[model samples]
Target: MLVEKNLPLQPFNSFGIAARALRLARIGSEAELQALIRHPDWSADQTFVLGGGSNIVLTGDVRQLVLKVEIPGRRLLRETERGWLVEAGAGERWHDFVAWTLQQGWPGLENLALIPGTVGASPVQNIGAYGVECQDRFDSLDAIDLETGEAFSLNAAQCGFGYRDSVFKHERAADGRGFGLKGRALITRVRFLLPKPWKPVLGYLDLERKMAELGLVDPGAQQIFDMVCAIRRAKLPDPALIGNAGSFFKNPSVTPEQCADIIARDPKVVHYPMPDGSIKLAAGWLIDACGWKGKTVGHAGVYDKQALVLVNRGDAEHPCTGGEVMTLARAIQTSVYERFGIRLEPEPVVL
Candidate 1:
């Protein structure tokens, strides 16, 4: 483990939030991680496992020791009668891995192409897009307990996967049955089971529009990957140029009766019936309806093109602080709640 003092965090996070880690340690291998945990001075310190920093909002300098997972490798473990089993290191870039899977003739991960963060962070957030969730392809994962320095493995059921949630996001129940990994567990590697007879997921609205625009009936994985990348580029701002998390709020789910009430009041309210019978409302539409798009508060502003995104209207010399971003987010949430009686939850982890 290589240790650094007062590490600048702007380059690490996608939002480019200006902050610092009081102490940071980069663990590029399992041995390094184990050695660091064995050190008497550091073993008891509070540590945060940081992946790609894409899904977090650092409000201030992190007081806890930051353990940056950089352990890296990728390989096809084995092919089963049902599907191809692949594994990647905790620190591997998420989007690049998806693209690599396609290049190697694996078709299942194409729909999730171009998502930010690392493979280790993927399961924690249950990252999904275009109708394919991590849980759908997740085989299992390996991790180590920060306090105990003990290694353990878990399958999908143990993950407690939900919409943008998992065991890693919650605290362990007092009864200790449902384990919440969260800060306690540091993921080392992730494995994916991409099934055979891979079928295209063309049910998403953007994919449908792409198919119609191209005058094609069926699209392949590469085509879908290209289309998703194109659509995202057209809609969302690149973090390299503009600092922002992809989506600011979760699409609030409501019952059919509740959906009807909202639809009755606002005829143009956008919604879709989920397979589980809940209706998912468009959070961006609600925010746009409240006139938050393109509005600026301090260094934070709502993206005009897509109200779902919040941007950093600051430069390297003066980047947007996490406080400003959260303040703006809270305001948006309150407005949406007051107007529609629906509480909008943020997608990113605020720290």
Candidate 2:
């Protein structure tokens, strides 16, 4: 295992925030990780596992030992009577993996195409788009315990998935009642169970509009993938062109009564009824309603096309700092809360 000191992190993160990793190591295999765990300088509490860096915000120089996961592979693990089990190394680009699965005739992940990140980070965020979430197709994952250097596996239930959250995002309670993995685990491989007799998820408004425009009553998996990519491209700015982490806020869920209250005040409020009876409000609508689109706060600004996205308006020479991004996010959150009485939680992991 080789370690580099004072590594620049501008290229690693999607937000293009100017930051550095004081010390960094690349773990390209399970053996490398285990070896690092046994290193004399190794400290679990002082290390941070970095995947594709698509879902994170680097607030400042990372003092932790940054372990950049570079493990790479993908294959069809097996085929069951009901579905196909596919596996991918943690470092595989999520969008490429989704497209690969579709090319191989698997259809379940089409709706999640074009999402930026690594497979290892997908479960940590329970990454979702349109109407499908990673948890819906997740079979299990293999990980290494940083403290014990022990290999283990966890099924979907063990992951404790919620909206853009999982056990990996939280720390264990003092009494050990909670099953939070947080920084204790490093995901190495992820397995997905793509069901046979696949059905497309077209419930989202953007997707429904695509279907109507194309006059596609029953679109195929590839078609849906194309449409999703197009929709995302039309709405989201490419990280290469404009530094962004896609949607910056999670759609807040409220009680039906709460939705009714908001609707009475603003009849045009965009909301969706969930299967669980809670109502999911469009976070973009809320931010737009608060007049945030195309607004700039310091070097951080809201994307002009999508109010849900927070972008870095500065160039590489004067990149936006993590503080600026968070400041703008906080301001948007405060405005949304003051107007709608609903708190908008940011989707990115602020580190």
Candidate 3:
């Protein structure tokens, strides 16, 4: 329950944007959070829950009271004949948790390896890589209502999962039809259901290339994890080295007719047919097609290797501001829209 004032936030966020939290508190357990809620000066509306800070853009100093979640633990909750139910504290590093699950002989999360952020933030973003998403293996999560200080749980359906979206991402509807949690709930623990008789997910192009190169007809979970990590490292700059939130934009989905129109203009347009009738376009291909790679704007720049990534080009002394990053992102969005008539939505949460 200790509060710090004017806390530096550059190290917390992946973008390395220079910013500060006006007041920050560390919440290490459910009881601590409840105690904070019961404080005389506590205001739920003025607080912001921060996890790994790996999926956000800080436009300026955070005026909201920042609650840095540091609760930590992981264990096999239960094992059934069908699958293994594993649980992790909200503050656990997502990549480390995935690797741990694999080491313990649990298998569903391999394809999502190397993704940035915390377990608490995973479902909020419905994080996905290759062909697997958090919702694919989600069992449920424990959270506390900030206003009421009441604890609750939600299954996958209650999460209302979508492409990089969940109930946590939207504001509560006025009419109550939307039923979003948004700023009202703080996730504490997440449970994952990793099924038995596990089979690797190997549908993405990069993975297929690895299989072909290695002559791997039946690669194991660990092999897929290794390949995913290698591929991501090859294309994305490590946040430790270059400040970046991986894949800045979400792949836009369009109608088949729209895809046909783009294909007619640029026959090389990269796209994949979804299980639904919609077609998902490669956002990187669109940005690259518009000539954005290696381009810089102020202190923010597009990663030279991956057009989908927006990076901080400045050093710690003269770091990029969230404004510069958003400016570059907007410019890229405008260019992609003007050329392809499709709007690219950024993936990171902008604050």
Model 1 TM-score is 0.97
Give the alpha carbon lDDT tens digit for every residue of 1-351 in model 1.
568999998898889999999999997877788788888877533888889988889999998989999979999999987899999999999999999999999889998988989999999999999899999999999998887788899999999999999999997777876676778888999999999989889888888998899887888889999999998888889999999988989999999999999999999998989999999999999999999999999999999899999999987677799999999999999999999999999999898
List ranges where model 3 is wrong by over 4 Å: 175-177
- Shift in Å, residue 225, candidate 1: 0.5
lDDT per residue (tens digit) for residues 264-339 in model 3:
9999999999998999999999999999999999999999999999999998678899999999999999999999
Task: Compute each candidate's TM-score over C-alphas.
Answer: 0.97, 0.99, 0.99
* Candidate 2 structure quality by residue, lDDT tens digits, 65-180: 99999889999989888899999999999999999998999889999999999999999999999999999999999999999899999999999999999999999998988888
Counted clashes in each candidate structure: 0, 0, 0
Better of 1 and 3 by TM-score: 3
